[model samples]
Target: MDDTCAGEKSHLFCGFFLNFSLFGTGVVYTLTSATSMRAIQRANCYHRDGHDAPCSVGGDAYYMFLFGLAQAVLLQIPGFHEMAGLSVFAAVMSFFYSFVGVGLGVAKVIANGVIMGSIGGIPMVSTTQKVWRVSQAVGDILFAYPFSLVLLEIELINTHEMRFDQMKDTLKSTPPENKTMKTATRASLVITAFFYLCCGCLGYAAFGDGTPGNLLTGFGFYEPYWLIDLANLCIVLHLLGGYQVYTQPVFGFADRHFAGDAASVEVPVPMLGKRRVSVFRLCFRTAYVAATTALAVWFPYFNQVIGLLGAFTFWPLAIYFPVEMYLTRNKVMPWSKQWVAIHGFSLVCLLISAFASIGSAVGVFGSETS
Candidate 1:
């Protein structure tokens, strides 16, 4: 009887161990596959047409690195253990700050260009195609093309005595006095900024404060499903907005620059050619929608990945670009007091952001592990 019982116990233990191992392996596989898919999607969307190809790769890697860093920082927030709900909120907020501070700053010009193009009406898309095409285009320009240009420009400016301010002044020889264009651009920027701020704050409140996870249990509110859906919708809109801002300009420029063969080839689209819409415009809008949807579905949590990219790339562009342009145009000495102070402050912010991103990424990894 005793011998039989011992054998049965051993069999039970072996079975349990096998099940546990399988579960662990499955979880790791899911996370790995998801991460890779997201990264690849971002790469393709931004690096299409080989524009900003190299920077896209570097930017993607940097985003992944920051994600790891963000994971680390979230682990250390105060009251994290006692307030599970708040911990999530804090985590969300941290992610937003890290990305906006870093990624948004780096891609400001591309972001600006996309915004300009979307508003200015890139040949084919209607105003309604506004959400997807504009947002994605902005994202692409900032992460892929403008980033590469900025890096190259910085190198050139550093080597030569020619200041970045001078370059800006030369570029800005005449102020854009067109009231309509100026008004539209300003309006677009303000609206976009407000939208981003609201979403970021709400996202932080829901996830960081644990409201999203707890809404069902704590307050007798409707299921958290609604909130998640709403969040996703907001993200979708944001993506669309960025697409229009960035992609339209590039498409327009391409059409103009490479007129012969490229021009003859009808912009790719299904039926709308018979309508009054230009073939180029129709193709642009249709392509933008399809691409945006495909990418958003393929990489559902792209906002996080984008935030990570922004963390490294966005900040420099935001603070440095305007100032650099100012200095370059004025032809000031590189060592001037004004130059030192402005660049110094911007550099410090960038450095702190880099560290924070690293910390947050660590926290994310730890959470997944635990």
Candidate 2:
């Protein structure tokens, strides 16, 4: 691979899709906590009226989008990378919420008698619908292990991982065949999958068909409102940190592309009396955040957004580019069995993800038009 090809282009595409995934993940987390608080309030209302109980938990997810727009202001801060250290604490907060969510779901099942409460309660959908949702679901779930691959790319320039010369050599320092990377990657994925399944089982058992997009909210903070408040607080903090990690690369990419070098290696802004700020940096990030926030405010269908983003973004980022890059790097033939099977499978996934996104877009928008 040409040095600069892997350098700028790979990072650009990686940042784009990686940020897409991160932004979506941020919305979900921010929404998760906010939705739980709403659910808690609704649960209180339901307690007074016997007929309103079932409807209490399925609150519309739109308000969360509005909140998302408000939070985007944080992305506009000048020293975003400085706050990146908070990600560690944010991660810890995430662990707490995940555990608490599972616990609440389990308790709900035991106390209220599972919602439809069984494996059988999982609704059967048409094959086409299943294909769309399944593809979307898998794409959303990429937050699990595959998300780490994007993060791992940072190790290349990270001085903590290597001395000076090693930092300069990306392929050697972080080879795809590295055993430690392979093990960590596989283990994190399995653990994440198991964690999600456990949480899903509990939530599904408690709410069944009415399970909220956020499993945490499905617990409905009736008895222990404190838990709902606490968990949501954690989510907010986590999202603050997450938004930066995903967008910092994007911010850097734009700054460099426009300024002709890294932000630190100052280049003069044109037509500004030698003002040094990368003004494109400001407009670019602000618009990106605004656009995402607007999308959130408009549709705000959490599951549907997941499906659409996965289908639209993941097929290219997660499936096609990586496979094509590998083949081109290794001089592998399209006719080779390994190439044929892997690339072919990628194509199939891309199709399914695309169709799923389209189907979801129609469903979301069609409802409004009608």
Candidate 3:
């Protein structure tokens, strides 16, 4: 890779997609938090009233605003590195929720005494509808690549270089940075894939053709009302940290670009260990949260939005860029076996991304029109 050329291109694509991914994630999280909160309320209502009673809950706008308020407050954390504890806490919450979901699925399956779904999946759908559903499912699964999203953040500009350096500084010198990163990526991917499979398969087995987009909030298991409530609460808490994890890089980028002639101003907050924070960070992040909140309220189709964002960004950021970088870095000769193989892989991924994007676009606009 020509250092200058690669650097410039990296800056362009990374900046745009990183911002897009983070903004979309903020919107998704906002909607998800609202859904989870609503689920909690509905769970309580169902438990109180009979299961057959009319326990309908209304708009999610209220919960969205509440989530936005929470984010505005939590957005005060100085930078990405400051969110270590928050990330850990969020991970714990996620594990708890995942476990709860899986457990509920198992219990439901046992209660039913048979796996609910068929090998064919949703038997009555038309061919076109099935194709669209399959494509959206692909996109939804691709949306699970938050691991790549985080790596993209660490691959951006000077701020990311600083982040990279921080990681190096923390790691022991024996295994080397490349090896360590690859290992960690593999491990994270494996663990994430396992959890996804467990939850998805079990949920399908339990609910079959009637499965909802989300296992926890879809009201699949109502008898364990308290457990469902706790699971949704964990989702809310997890998303609270998740929003920061995805957006802090954007915050860092803005702080760098928008640092005009004005001298940096730091205000001391006695509550937060007397840590001084930038006033610009406060204003900018608050506005960012508000914008995302507004978008979430405007277009709140969670699954479609996730599909669009994932399919739209997947190939370029996750596949093509990385492959090109690798080929360039290793000086792979054009049309050589390695080059052809790598490009072939990228081409296949590009096609998949394209298909997914079309499906997701249809879903998004279709929902809007209807």
Instruction: Show pairs that collide, candidate 3.
Output: none
| lDDT by residue (tens digit), candidate 1, 1-370 | 1233235654444334332322222222222233443434433444343433442333233333333233222222222123333323433543443343223222433433422222243343565444333443343223321232222222322323234446566754332334434454455456545545543343333333332211211221222333423333333233222222223333444356543343323332233342233445445444433443333333333323342333434444444444555666677678889878878987876664465444333333433455
Report the CA-based lDDT of candidate 3 relative to the real structure.
0.82
- Predicted structure with the largest lDDT when compared to the true one: 3
Instruction: List residue ranges in candidate 3 displaced over 4 A.
Output: 1-7, 152-175, 261-279
| Candidate 3 lDDT, 242-289, residue by residue in tens | 898888878888888994543455555446654545667778888999
- Model 1, poorest ten-residue lDDT window? 213-222
Error of 1 at 192 (Å): 5.4
Clashes in each model (backbone N, CA, C under 3 Å)? 72, 0, 0
Candidate 1, superposed: residue stretches over 4 Å from native:
1-208, 211-242, 263-299, 356-370
Reference-based lDDT, each prediction = 0.37, 0.60, 0.82
Off by over 4 Å in 2: 1-73, 76-84, 112-184, 219-221, 259-283, 329-333
Write down the lDDT that model 1 would get.
0.37
Higher-TM-score candidate of 2 and 3: 3
Of candidates 3 and 1, the better by lDDT: 3
Q: After superposition on all CA atoms, what RMSD does each candidate show versus the true structure?
A: 25.9, 6.9, 3.9
